[model samples]
Target: MENTRFNPVQLRRARIARGKTMTVLAKETGISRQMISNYELGKTIPSGNYLVKLISNLNFPKSYFSSGQASNLHGATFFRSQSAATKRARDMQSVRLSFQNDIYSVLSRYVNFPKVDIPEPLDMNVREMTDEIVKSMAMQIRERWGLGTSTPVDDVIRTAEVHGIIVVKTNMTNDKLDAVSEVIGGRPFIMLTDNGESSVRRRFNVAHELGHLVLHAGVESIHDFTTQQLKNTIERQANLFASTFLMPDEAFTESLLSTSLEYYVKMKKYWKTSIQSMVYKTYQLHLINDDQKLYLNKRISWNKWRRVEPLDDMLKVEEPTLFQKVFRMIVDNGIMSEADLLSELKLPFDELECSLGIKLNNKMAVSEPKLRLL
Candidate 1:
């Protein structure tokens, strides 16, 4: 049954998930911006023709608007793009994150997901962290996870999932956002933008977020109690962690015969990391001087290898199986059908697929969300 009682939080969530700002939604719904705000703020609920406009425009089940207990995340959410992604964009992403969490909450009861196995954040703040410390943490965790320095992480995504971290890819369609990680319902979930890039690129991005999960505790956003320099420090430290974890110090140093672009390009296959990242790693390790680093960068730009690196096309991108298996076990095994989900959870079809990282195939199977234009 449709919920006539409008819950403002859910209204705000629908607006954000639909990627419509209030002004845009106002124009689309043929309603005043202030009125839209009023409805979302719960000062007054949209009713009658106003409600019809909202239902038609926003495109969420009417029941969703009044779904009980729309939980909000207050934890520190780490984004790959700090300065690039706008606040509104991040808010939209967060709303989706909450929706995904709800999906997880419902499905998890039926499926016992793997126990989370990542190490705790280091006992230090961003201010107290150092380059050496960050690298050390990365190495330690590798050994802890039974991955010694030299072994190429053939499937970092699977490694993360096996260890209890939820990884999913969604098409945020924003170049700025490569990945985002937030601890939801006491589980750390990493959302990678479903950009069809190199597996090497995906590996680095996942490692980068893993760095945040391990090294940067008590430091979530740039807006936190951190100066821009501290933010840069954490960001760079994460990069260092990614590099060190993927290309361990001892093994990688031995592998670096030359700082030339050709040498790193060849090494990319062995390391299963990007040539660009490997070049920067060589410089960061001080194995290559400024002039050599400058020369390599020039080579990268000259060949246009910065964006699409050599062999990026050949390397298969890693896929997250945890969520896929969860859904398969649930729906494929007849625990719940798509219609059952809509009837029970009141989820938007497209949003549900994106959140769970699985398509329902037949959107027509679910009942039309009791939302129609009058």
Candidate 2:
């Protein structure tokens, strides 16, 4: 029944995190668009009935609007296909990243998450980056991570989590954006799309984002590359990193017994890589001549295997469970109630579920046991 103090930035974050425009939020909450804009701009504050309505609609605790530290994705964010993505889509993902950072901040108080373990920054000039240099960079990373050339990465998401990289799967349905990675608070964070892509493609996407984090650490902004040539070069470097990182030369070359599509299909299960990727890697390694490579491409196009491939359903999709497990520990160990956790996060039930890829059964109170007196 009283007025509550509101932070304009928090209000804006809540709206962006929900992917709602001013008019849409206004209609949903029965508030005027002008008033919402004024509140977000710090010109005024919501009070009494309006404040209650905001709390109910935003699903944020009243305290959240009053006191909280705000963090943003400060470093460069490498979208898979930046040119194809719209500005609104990028902003929505950025808001989602900020929300994830807030969650990480809350969890850090109770649990110690893994420390970030990205490789040292490369000293090569972006303009002079060659395929050979990129391949060597990938090799160095493998050595640093203790991943041998022959060893296949069983689960890229788990590997990243263990190495202190926070991986989140987002519910962004945009086909143009496969994934994006950034550095925040001196840590690496990657967000993958939950677009029902095959596990193999998902793994490659994770690796590709990792490539951006390592290769473009010093670049200011992805858009800073004004020339299409420069942009293509950097993207090519990341692609090379992903290819070499996933399929090392020695082991991958050894497995290439033939240049036929059928051979690659059989090898797909062993490498856990898409047949197309394997075909490309084979050509990159020069195991198959250009003619052979062109023929293979024609075959892939003929069968439409570019979009869907064999063994796509068989390979298990890697997911991040660390955050969900930590949340469960906080509740199950009595560190915090589900209500408190949700309130602290300022996320609605559906958003929380989507962000963490887990369901929330909010009935989390522990029941007291009866005592028997003999």
Candidate 3:
């Protein structure tokens, strides 16, 4: 059959993500290396028989061959193809979400945190707006949450995770979006990166994605954060959410009377915000002039402070990931089988094995070695 309709870019992306050179993949699948290059460059498509062999050996499903659907599911950025690896990655994500949701439901019973209200984002150009509105909204959110005193970043992360948020590792290879939040129905679901980013930056990414779930629901807009274009009002709202959540102006202003570097240094300890964030927030609150803002920005840039710092210095709470907890519960309770998950998630058997990093064939199937051999 003809392979002309498939996308070469997708093929290239899938191959690269799996870290397999054309020669390596060709050897594994018994396909010619030259043909692999051709497929990746869009010069030619694989025959039906060859394609099936590729998918089986690659451990991907038939759906991965389609560029449009697979690419869209991945937010159209990093992984371009629907290779076996991609399908497994997506399945792992879904399983993780399933786990997170269950844990969140249980945690909600004990936590009394106020639920964030979803509001329609005001229709204004995000780029044109000043930072004051963002600051004000953040203050409002903090007040609503009653986080009056300073809290550790670990506490904040735990609380968000309990509310169905999952943190992901971000790298140069992710979708061009700084963050993406997806929540089914009205629940707030978000994915963030620890990336050793400053406590303040991490908080901002979390709150920003949360803002999307609450504010941009039911909207059709581009979510890419790389392009230099006028952002939709919704994107602006999310950024505002992130800024305000990380640095509440009232609490910040109330505690400080001076703009000296010493004062900022002292406050940074409690707020756990980066010096740059403190400077930006200070400028946003009109606590400093444009000159100070420029100077501070230059200082930060010169220091190359954008690099993420290790969080080893901070306290780490035992917050199990959503999927892990849920999968454990299901397995422990005999609520489902490995087969059930594979079929529900549309993952090939081996892909499931790779994604979970567990020996499912043995562990998932072998009936609990007769605990009572009475």
Candidate 4:
């Protein structure tokens, strides 16, 4: 094969996107670790068989490394449990984001994706973001989206995607990191763990991440919260935002009907929210007394509903379809062949399949000629 000059940055991205250390990549490619490091550092370029070995091991097309586009994350990510996630796991997630950026870049060439529609950050310091302010912001967002207080958001994932928020569902090794959100290249991207979580919980998670994008976008880092109180306040604010966004005051309060946990259970089918979430929302809205809230918590714990709640099977998971639609458009319109699209993506077919939650098959057939009628 002819030698191709590869970009060191793309090489490193492909390696890290696979969550492989330099040593592991070297072992797979039958190359020295130092040589791989040298290639990534731009000290030396891989050529001939060395380049072929790297491409085969990385599963990226030769053009991917030669392409000038760079994968860069612009802002911080708000992890669900920042302290519980290891630094290695976070770094791997960043690499995954970089790969996603690359995929988006390719898709942009063929389709006009919706511009991100998140509201402007509120004019308040992080220290001044109280629960009331957060609730107000959530209500304002609902209004801006034309979602009336009483209407239940049927598909939160689709809602976000329609507003240009890229939602990715992937299997993460760190179970503590339930979901994460970030602003990359001025666009918001959210990643949810594909761990068989209930639809209600996933919708809440998406709303929670949206809270971070809207509320905490100004904060440089969560680590800046030196005190535990500050950290708790930030998280509490996001939680409040999620609750308020999902169940607005006017509708949720009227639907309260009763303070019993069973009442919340029956309401869950309508609201598409978890019973536990409704209980907390009720308490936050002062519909239930402190003792009532405690009783509901005990009931939840005693019945083992904390992990597996009721009606979990009934609510369907909201899968994203924008990317799939764009991919199909490009292929069906003959803009690009499936093989070419896969090559441009620089991702393994299986990996892309898992990321998009769809299958890719080459079964295009031409129609047979019709016989003339006598």
Name the weakest run of 10 consecutive residues (lDDT summed) in model 4: 364-373
Candidates 1 and 4, the one with greater TM-score = 1
TM-score preference between candidates 1 and 2, better one: 1
In the range 307-337, model 3's lDDT, one tens digit per residue, is: 5322324623232254444545565666666
Model 4 lDDT at residue 315: 82
Ranking by TM-score: 1, 2, 4, 3
Clashes of 3: 4
Over 4 Å off, model 3: 1-52, 56-58, 61-154, 164-177, 185-187, 193-199, 223-226, 231-236, 308-320, 337-374
The segments of candidate 4 whose C-alpha lies over 4 angstroms from its true place after superposition are: 1-4, 26-30, 47-58, 171-173, 226-231, 362-374
The all-Cα superposition gives candidate 3 an RMSD in Å to the true structure of 9.5
TM-score of 3: 0.58
Better of 3 and 4 by TM-score: 4
Of 3 and 4, the candidate ahead on lDDT is 4
lDDT of 3: 0.51
In candidate 3 the C-alpha lDDT for residue 207 amounts to 69
List model 1 lDDT by residue over 1-374, tens digit each: 34447788888888887778999998887899999999988898777689877877876766677777686675578778766777777776777777767777777878998998877877477777788898898998898889988878879999999899888876466677678888877788888876676799889899999998888767655576444664478788888899899999889999888777787878988899998888888888888899988988998999998788888888888887787778778878888875775556577766666656676757553475454555
lDDT of each: 0.79, 0.79, 0.51, 0.78
Put down candidate 4 lDDT per residue, 214-234, tens digits, no spaces.
Answer: 998777766667547444777
Candidate RMSDs in Å, in order, are 2.3, 6.1, 9.5, 7.0
What's the TM-score of each model vs. the native? 0.93, 0.89, 0.58, 0.87
State the weakest 10-residue window (summed lDDT) of model 3.
Answer: 75-84
lDDT for position 129 in model 1: 79
